[model samples]
Target: MTAVEPRTPADPATTTELAPAAAPWWTTAVVYQVYPRSFADSDGDGIGDLGGVRAKLDHLAELGVDAIWLSPVYPSPQHDNGYDIRDYQDIDPVFGSLEEFDALLAEAHERGIKIVMDLVVNHTSDEHPWFVESRSSTDNPKRDWYWWRQPGAAGAEPNGWGSAFSGPAWTLDETTGEYYLHLFAKQQPDLNWENPEVRQAVYSMMNWWLDRGVDGFRMDVINFIAKQLDLVSGPAAASDEGSPMGAQIHDYLQEMHREVFAGRTGAHLTVGEMPGVSIDDAVLFTDAARAEVDMIFQFEHVSLDQGVHKFDPLPRNLVALKRSLARWQEGLAETGWNSLYLNNHDQPRLVSRFGNDTEFRYESATLWALVLHLHRGTPYIYQGEEIGMTNVRFEGIEDYRDIESLNHYREAVEQFDQSPASVLAGVHAMGRDNARTPMQWDASAHAGFTTGTPWIAANPNFPEINVAADRAAERSVFRFYQQLIALRHDDPVVALGDFELLEPEHEKLYAFTRTLDDRVLLVLANASDTPLTLQGEWVPDDISGAELLLGNYAGDGAAALRPWEARLYRL
Candidate 1:
């Protein structure tokens, strides 16, 4: 692909150029997540690349998103789908070259859209130069860049901690005669932030990207930056092998803020993927004093139905779901910002999991939109989510691609002696492959993701549920999201107002009000299949003659809400 040079900085004299005015860009900004591998493919290499993403920037801008978060395009060995970065400053060959990445940044900014790269600093690929050299010999200059330890008295692992994906977290290196820590996969070695030189290296790399005009970073597994120094194993939440390393993580984030990401100016945003963190702990990481991250994506709501193991699936509970969301809303309201999202590259599609996508997919999808966006946070719309995409079903274990999903299947079938059919059933219910399917651009072969075979199969229902069809329909979920985003940006109260839950006791209904000075916004969603009635003292007097701003149902004014129906009202 031809390299597109970065546009020259705006001139002060010729075009009446001036410094861009300061605005709370992130407050009302609608971010669209692009899973680059499945988004688009320009080279017909059966994989999406940076040039493909650049070509799709106009499509994203037209979709009404204010920003784009490109998932893990950094240089990697494709282990864990680019989450294990080999080089923070370079793009992977499969994705594109650095020049192509520069072109993508220039094109996105020229389109009035900011781009946030995925920052995977918690760990680096074992193939990374730093890790390769660090693991070469104990006394090497880069040896302390990653956590390493001598074997226990019996020549076993130092602790009982297990890898998040599977097996032991400590991987033995015969060459160095020691075990190195890896929270996820053996190929992804955890960085040693305790080393000041390591922290400085990371900070320097971050500033390099920021100075290149990249808007911000969507930090990958950010809270894991700091691990317990003592290396003592604690009681496990579920299994006896895996220990929860929560305390030291937050402390490291505080230091990250002091040394790297404080007081950055306009358009510089940072959202951290901090799993297993309490609401109080999340507040500390996002507090203005810490200044570590602008917002944090909490997994409480997503993990409600997840079984004792991460891949195990259980029946969904509406009541528990309400409580989880309410906790985060109230917990972060006073202290920090919440990053609201239901589906991402790591989870199943929201339509299939949360709502009855078989019958009311579009309505439920729009209803979820109304529910999540109305909350106090910057909303992130995953690719193909606007059209109510559903999860895919695989025939065999060979059909799966995600390492975590495959490991879970092996554990359930081989280790636990479960049937193969039963294991696939569980995987069908909850697997990362559900989100890794190719983006459904249109009904063409491979969902128009590529002229040739795609790296992964596109969702089978692409023809019926796709961007082209939704963009043409006025009542489509796509348009509903567009309207919701516009309303949020146009109304200041919706963006920065105080959020108050209305009728917290309602089991199947979730309602909230956002009030700032004289402006009041009421959001209601029926989270069940049965129709629900709006009642009680929480309904404000101002909305007694409220206008129906948006809804999934079509009818006269103040119409009743159907099953899984949602509405937004403003007075």
Candidate 2:
């Protein structure tokens, strides 16, 4: 294959290029996220790979998700679970060869399913050739590719910025005698986006991937691409949530658009993972007319359940969640789009976090599905979320593989001097490993993920929660998700309707309305295990002749909603 030539920087003279006329298919599509290392393991290497993902494409197609977002499959040191990319162009040997990746891409495209890659340009593995060269000598031509700086007074670090993995953000390179900035792990140095050379290289790599057959990208910590030029120290905090999303980010994104994505013509999808973004920031970031990013994964909704510590299980205020969702809806109603999600590789399983993981597991899973998919956004389903997967209670930290979780445990117990039991409890409650458990395909040894041991333990409840069991059951959570995906495609109101949340003050019931072209759809859900009194804005008489499009339990009255029940009524 011919290499993609580097394109010249975009001239400000022709910057006001308008987006395409019609909305693209992603506007209504539901994306399924595949954490490749945990999704499957065909090679018996105890880790999942591209060949494993290829074998499961049928499952995604059957589940009805229009696209699949496969998290970082590039060559990496497996530090931070493949996010520390060593090579931007080739498939990891652990995953498969580039030939196998090409086959997977071809097969997915042939099945009408778009493949979205996890683009990790914020940093690269210290072992990457560029990083190695940069650290080799201060006089190296590529030394400026990364953020290398001088030590502070008294041989102190460059800045007080903290690492996301619980350490100083800057690491001193002994060979160069200069510190390099790393927003996350020390092994993953932050790229200097200020360099025009760096920007050209990144844009060229993106074009190379696009020139190949992938459909889109889920950019990792994209907002952190451009940090404050001064590199000022921020307030000291235990956890480094990375850099703040600043105003300069827009300029960088616009430059990226003009160079890498300008002429794509709405054919590809882009979702920026903006950690510090508020509703106001998201408006400008995801606004279609701006051509910055097609959508963004916001952190506010997911962080609502956490207090100062992620493990402290604070009672999630239902009203606050409703209000927050409403705020984003109103903020992005005019020009921007929203990407709705409940679970992901970095987050704990939704059933355990937000829903009843025990008695009302299936019902709560179905309930949350309706609430999110019915909203005015493209819904994303994490792997095993369709089967009502729950969190695991691993007794020791040695069993966990996440860098963030392990670092937090060490910091809490060793540095901050917190109780081991309390920190362990926190890991049990909020560790990312909770969602990274091997996919439970059947009630077999190792959950049929592999005949060999899995890299991580499969959830012990696989006997009850496996996909094979759901497939045979009369009504399963998987089936409900399928219906939700189908609804987005079959019903226009589900995709483009105006959203109105009802009963924001209700503690146990989540209700909302979606209106489009005189077609009104009411989505009502009982969020708890026990039945709750149904009294709110919508009375039983409000829509006397509404058609019941879908529901989990049988009941017809405004007086009471059964436990774990939800219904979609079209009036």
Candidate 3:
């Protein structure tokens, strides 16, 4: 298939703008991420449930998003929220019944919103029946369903690989006298995709969801499923772990497509989350003809702030950021596509990590989003991101939830020789719990997220910076997001325009241009707290008849960018 390159203008002096794409809805789609546990509580329960999300479908539809990418709501032990699945086919009671899910699908679709369910097939809950039967005895037929290895010569772990949460990835199964691998928490055991039975089981579950009217899947660690080789040592310090770049992962994905989705007639999207994936690898993963996944969530940009430590603070490298994104843009321009997001449920809030959350909080959050939506890809807006939501502020480690943070606290201090106080501060700054705070809807007690105590506390600043307040204000983040979403729907430049990074050496400014035919859209963002004079062709005098399309402040191409300001223009 030929790549769809943007049409060039016939003349350099006057560019003609192209109309919006009329096919392939996702090419310019905006996806809203709903962390069901914190979105809302319909039953007055402390925990947010499916009914809670159902009540808020109108809010999503009004936001102008094309789809909602819900986090996992499958039955689990709640060890890692719902990522550890005890049952793939049933809904957990807290999230309402399967009938309620059907209702949500109907309601969202009624409002023209597609539902992309989170698929956590990389691992299964240890409490799951398959894992239980596998652990019952070494001779059990299901024993090979999960990775089980005999102790090494010294009775050590199967290998030196480490769990993402920390420590060895293997846990001793005393009953079976073997070690089982878990890339995440011990409660979440890695499935052996090398086993054909496991492959069929996962594919069957996927078809079940599709038959239930689900739109697509946001596959959790899907690329890591094919660990076709034996577990082995990692780096000097880390333990053995599974990576998506495993040689046979391609074959597994292809086989899965042939078995599960080849005959599908509709736009059922699939996005794989690959943390360390390269652009070359991503090309194959998302190639239109390859029939694997539609796109992938790459972690290079998010990891830029961390050193070896996830909590360690490092200044954002603007030049590196530009190159990282540009490479993905160029590499996939022909064969694949991109999934754009600055923050998600597992990362720190966008405004808190990359924007100024103090005086210029509104400008910075809006600016960060300005850059995100302009990229040539499917954009994801995480829950609470639309209204400039900042990260949480918990006074003590005891107040923090999520095993990822809790485990880090223990291991970082004991094994990593880090100070307890410093680690606590780091967790406060960069922990996943920061993004998991309950959504701030109104100024009522607990942000009106629940009638009773909330599963997590709402941000204390909710009164001044929440949906109710933003919706009421003349100029608010919520309104800005709506405008951006509308622009993508109305202009083909946003969905299929060619991307060009401008001023690659600028320190405080991130500027880029998008072109489709004679029309061009220029985006200038001040990523810092200080002002920067706009330059290059984007300066008002250089481009004729440029009109400001979106901006955080009342400004133009001729005006100086205020602190943390972002502006978009069309010429």
Candidate 4:
């Protein structure tokens, strides 16, 4: 647990001699996300901890990732799997102690990897000290730290806002004779950013972590930092719950940057998860002027299939997915950088959801890598994604843990009047918990996760798709990802280049090119099961002699794409 200096080439200049960059650091790096519960567990506690993550530094280093974005490992009640942070500065005992976390940072840095901790600032667990005190009394100083409202006429709820999980967003506090706001679970109370002191406190906490050798942060729901002061009902969109102050969120983000992040070391990065933001709104957050975030991870493509039902469907159209990526690429090219991602803690596995995992799992996983990494954006690789992890099938509702997933199942079965079996099927299709399962390490008992019982069961496919097995195979998805990442780092065209969509009108194929100066990188992805040949006007003139850089197809370069095959070519 001792603080070890980074073993990678250290900065030649001293801290005092280092000049701060005009913009933050994340813009220039690739961040790999690690869901701690699934990442590793050194103590055999059935849950991944800091020590376990530290033990895997070699694995990450071999993969050639630049940074590690760990999901919240802070003190929490685990009501929402550490998203409900009870304390920001302390590591959750379930994950490990503060000393262990410090060791994780030191070890990760020694492997040439930066660590970006998940910053869940929008809300805190109901058990958080601040929330407990705030809820204790109406006159408490911390009472104003949270959003609390009085009862409306006839004691009806203040508004029709629904929580993201289910039920009313407002939870009545009998002790205070008022209702407090909870956008997700009642256990999580939304913080009142309108309070200047609260903002200052948050900034102080961020600086505290940064000073402790942490490189940066992957801000969770950062756009929700700002709320509408009026607390008016939000306009109905795909969901009834509107951000109370969705319009003013950016203003608060700007303030956050100016006060907390501005003029910090260039190595300090911040990637914001802003869910309902438009391209223009996204640009505002990442624009140099804003200084709030280096890049933004929007969910336009991820939510394509999530219709009126919360978690029960597949992508509606492959064309829509391509269009969404194109739109974001074009819109953010000049304004700011995009944080490209297909899999994360809150979504299902990419191979299973977008590619065919049942038949061509390895090829599909590699194809997904080629598709996302070739885009003109910094790519984020989720844990277990390189090895093609698939969705877990729960036998019944009792097997589920995610609040959102369980709530949807109840709504579908109890409220919507659907059969329990059908509801379970829908939950299996898109439950966020699918991504939350333990990371499959090996084929041993419990996926080699822990000697004791795990917090959640590991996917049964771990034996076939595991790190050890893939590491030995030259053509494994894990190795393919390494090559893909290396290409991004070595080729300037693949990194900071211009993106031009080729044959965007193709219904079953998505192809694009990245060009910078004279160098060009061409990428093609078969978004369907059937083979399709695409001829385009923008095909590189030198492509006649182009060499295959990377691909998911099984045979030689001439082999046609199976399902969800992705290819990258250098010309």
Top candidate by lDDT: 3
Clashes of 2: 0
- TM-scores of all candidate predictions against the true structure: 0.92, 0.93, 0.94, 0.92
Instruction: In model 4, state the lDDT of residue 50.
Output: 85
Stretches of model 3 off by over 4 angstroms after superposition:
1-23, 232-244, 536-541
lDDT of 3 by residue, 246-347 (tens): 677888888888887889876677889987888999999998788888899999888888876788868778888887888788888877899999888999
lDDT of predicted model 1: 0.79
lDDT, candidates in the order shown? 0.79, 0.83, 0.84, 0.78
Distance (Å) between predicted and true CA of 261, model 2? 2.3
For 1-571, candidate 1 gives per-residue lDDT tens digits of 1111222222111211111233246777778999999889998888888888988877776666778899998888988999988888888899989899889988877777788989998899999999989988999999999988888767777677788888888888999898888989999999888788988899889889888888888999888787766553322222434234547676666676666556665557789998778888778877866666788888889988878766668878877887788788888887888888999999899989998887888878988988888887889999889888899987788888899988888887889898889788878878898988887878788888888888777777888878887878766777677677766565677677788877777777778888878777788888888877655675666665787677788752243558888878876
What is the per-residue lDDT of model 2 for residues 298-320, given as tens digits with 9 covering 90 to 100?
A: 98888888888666667767788
lDDT preference between candidates 1 and 3, better one: 3
Model 4 Cα lDDT, one tens digit per residue, 1-571 = 1111222222212221222333233433467899888888899878888888888888888777788898999888888999999899898898889898888888877777888888998899999999999999999999999988887766656676788898887888999788888888999999988788888999899889988988778888887767765553322222444455466677777877887677776567788988788899878887876676888889889989876755668664777888899999999988888889998888888888887788777767887788888887789999988788899997878878888988878877888799898778778878888898888888898888888898888777788878888877766777777777666655556667788887767777778888877777788788776776544564556655777777776543443555677777777
Clash pairs, model 1 backbone: none
Query: Candidate 1's error at 250, in angstroms?
Result: 4.8
How far is 338's C-alpha from truth in model 3 (Å)? 0.4
